[model samples]
Target chain A: MIEVRNVSYEYIKNSPVLDDISMTFERGKTYAIFGPSGCGKTTLLSLLGALDAPTSGAVLFDGKDIAQIGDENHRKDNVAFIFQNYNLIEYMTAAENVSLTEKIDPLPYLLQVGLTEDEAKRPVLKLSGGQQQRVAIARALASDAPVILADEPTGNLDEDTAAEITKLLCDVAHENNKCVIIVSHSAAVAEAVDQVVRLSHGKLQEEV
Target chain B: MSIFKRAWTYVSRTRKKTASLCAMMCVMLLLSLVGIMLHGVCMDASQNLKEVLGGYVRLTYSASNDREESVLDEALAAQIAALDGVADYSGISTYYLSAPDVQLVAGSFAGQPQGQVPRFVGCDKSALHENFIYNSFEVIEGRHITSADEHCAVVSDVFANLNGFTVGDRFEACLDSVITQDEAMPEEVYSLEIVGIYTIHEGWEITPMTPERDIAENFIFTDMQTADAVLLAEHGVEKPFYRQGVIFTLNDAERLPEIARSMQNMDGIDWENFELVVNDKAYRDSAASLQMLEKLSLLLVIITFSLSGILLALVLTLWIRERRHEIGILMSLGISKVSIWKQFLLETAIIALVAMVVAMTLSVPCSRMLSEKAFDVAETMAQSQAEEVHDPMADVMEKLNPTADAAVDVVQKDDVHLTFAACITIVLCTAGIITISVTLSAVPMFRMKPKEILSDVN
Candidate 1:
């Protein structure tokens, strides 16, 4: 579970990217943050991942303020992130990329994300875009964190591949007791998750 | 992960950069090695020369213009020898010899006679002897004049060969002054036999007084009795002559001036006709050379560090810039800024260590070669200067007759060794350069925010 109370962020003062935003999500559920470009969706994901702290108010995880948990350890032990470009280390193989934290065997998680053993061993650069995305997902899963924040996770894949990635994310949330929050502009990606939180003009509104 | 593993991974990934760093290190190390070797050789040469040249003072009597002018007597020589700080003392007497101007003749002094020549020296017999300071002479053939033999003489091998004389061969020598009809006036000619031959072979040509006078190749050595007899015969005098001066080798060179000053003021001595000269100019020259070596070594270290710093900085800056994405990823993975900085430093330190080992291995032979070349150049220059001063034609003529000359004995040879302290200094300097370069290169990486780095890459 996570909560945002009157949170605002700006890279520079007088130029706000997120303004007075408030939201909450329950545990063991997938939430899709749907927004057009420049709606602070990625900023919200970064805040949730503890990569950056909100300038005012708080972003809370499991009813405790993340700012109090120490950002580095908080990110290390509690949350994992998947980026739009599937930021796998280019120098490493798929398995190494998936086990970025090196905390567990990434093969089982890669298999759960629909990658063959041979594919997992190959360099991530040699993999298809959808396969690389699955490897990124496997990395997040392998971290054993309860929360996964994916920013535009299916942005580079075809419709069928995007659907498969969306199903994989949903399966991780429902079957693995994870809170999977995906920030996306795609309507199909939003429909695949358990719930949607629409963000526009620095405000969050829940949609049925 | 271990720092060593991280360092190895980075170094393995950047093979080209590692190679370039190694080359630079090798060059720097070679220069430092050359500096160290030169310093060692210069110091060794100085110490060798000092050991061979005895102490600093060259004590001798001043020439008398009047009969009343006093020469050093036995009592005076004894008194001076009793002075404190006197390490050793010796006396020598020299006289010109008339011999046959023969070519390729040996074992006999039979040929056409040459005119009498002038010879200058101090007599070493009775109280003071030559063996006390035998290092001043080099014997190429036969042996040194150890006792006061009335019939024995040690002639230089160069003079003996030119005049066709050998060991045990008899030859006639004349004194500088001979007594004529006038009892008050003395003439300069007498005859004696040669018994031994010595050589001065430092290879440095002796400078001549005139273009036509020819630098003398003739050298003769004899006991004080034979020398005294030859002088008595040349002067035609019945009165015994005492030595003009006593040569003292002091226990320490620093005491030379003090002892000389004290001897100048001793009672029963003629201060006007007696002078003490500390022959420390050679020591001064060697000291100057040592100082120059120190300056050159310091300059070399400065140049090595300055150039290495700039080069390492440029290369490491590019390396750090190339790894910006990795830095961002690591930072985002919750690796602390300090840890990231440490990794980069560890990488450079590993590469530098390998380079230092390789460079040190190569420098030994390279430094030796450089030292040999430098010594050769110095020797060549000394030879050329000697040649310019004493032309070969004049040298040959002087070889027939030597007069009013001071012979130099060369005993020291070339031997140099590198020291542990010097090697340590070189390694420390190299490590310092790397530390500074690493710190400077990491500045940009440390200044960046993780999000900024990631966004820039994206």
Candidate 2:
């Protein structure tokens, strides 16, 4: 489980991208933060993932401040991130990219993400956008971390592929008892998650 | 996955980048290797020059001085011999002796006397004589005239044969009129026993005016005491004297000029009466060429090594910048910055080691070609400078002592060879350079936060 306590972030003086925002993510459930572009949806997800420290507040994991746990250690042991642009290492094969977080074989995870053995072995650069996104998701799932922070997990995929990826994220939370937080503007992604949180004007509110 | 596995994946899969880096490394390493080998060769040549020149400083009365028969005393010789860089010093005083009872070798002119006056040269140690040191004279039978011999002599083989003389043969000689023309000779003649017989590899020019005593075969070597006793007995001279100055052999030939200058400024010797002649021209000329080569080699080493390090750092930095996106992704996957650094280090190390091996394999022939070219360049530079600053006295000195010419020949023919120690030095230096370049490139990357790196989108 992860929580943000009154987090505020500023890219420049007097210009806050995220301000006084608070949220909680629990295991065995999936949460989606939905907002327009430049609304700090991804910034909030980054704070929760320990990728960036909040300027004014704290991000906690399992009731302990993630800062005390150390940013790198928290990221390594508690949270895994999936970037919007499918930031897979181009030099690695699809399975190798999936295997970046752990030393185990990545073939089973790649297959679970709907990639054939042939596609899994191919370089990640050679894969299609949807397939690269699948590799990114597989990389997140391969880690033993308790939380997944995905920024625009399917933002580049087709409608059907986005729907399939959303279902996979939901299944990961439900079946593996893991916390899944996704930042996206897609309504379908928000509809599939267990809870929908809307962010606007540097603040967050749950869409009951 | 493991860091090595990840690093290997990038290095093996990115074939073009790895090859480009390897080629660059090989070129730079070859240049440094050539520099090292050439430096080694120049050092070896300098050492050989020292052995050949055997720096000898002659301190005696100047021929143009107004004082006739001015004496170079034993005390002065002792003071000079005690100077720094003086390995050993010997006094040379020649007395022309005519053995009227012996059948001496005939001179060149047909009308001259059958047996000419031969030079009786005395020194502390006859073995250290310039003729023997230069290999122009070698004792073939019996022992040399050492300092212990009081009345012993080493004659030339030609002189011994003409007189039918052998070792232990006693001979008597009157002081010839050449040195004592103004003074009367003593009633009793100096008697000496032949102790050694020497053969001449080189001899003097035979001209109508040339004296028999000036020929190499007619020269006789004796100890200082004998010459001193002859002087005391024949001329009634009370003090030990050297008509020909003392020759001081130096330990280091390179320091000849410095030692010569220092001797000129010493307190005891009267510089006005005596002239110090340092035979350093041969060593100076050859050492100049070697010193030029050494400096050039040093500059080559600095430039190539520095440029190589900068080039490698630039190449690796650009590559790391291009891989910023992948770096962000790795960091997002919870891989620590240290792990990522280790991976990059592994990648570059793999390529650098392979490049070093390839360069080493090709180094022998490359060093040979490059060193030869460098030597030619340095020689050309030295020759041009030498032509501009010509020493007319060098020819005179060479004629006086043929050892200088032989030394020049030896140095010019010296070859450069790459030794194991040089190779090891190169390897250790290259490894240090590569590590520094890698660390320089990696430091700034890891200093940044994962968020900033991910935001680059490059």
RMSD in Å for model 2: 5.7
Error of 2 at B305 (Å): 3.7
Clash pairs, candidate 2, are none
lDDT of each: 0.64, 0.80
Q: How many Å off is the CA of A181 in candidate 1?
A: 2.9
Stretches > 4 Å off in candidate 1? A1-3, A24-27, A60-69, A98-100, A103-132, A173-177, B35-55, B65-90, B94-200, B203-270, B281-294, B380-418
Q: What is the TM-score of chain A in candidate 1?
A: 0.93
Model 1 residue B333 distance off true place after TM-score fit, in angstroms: 0.7
Q: Provide the global lDDT of candidate 1 against the true structure.
A: 0.64
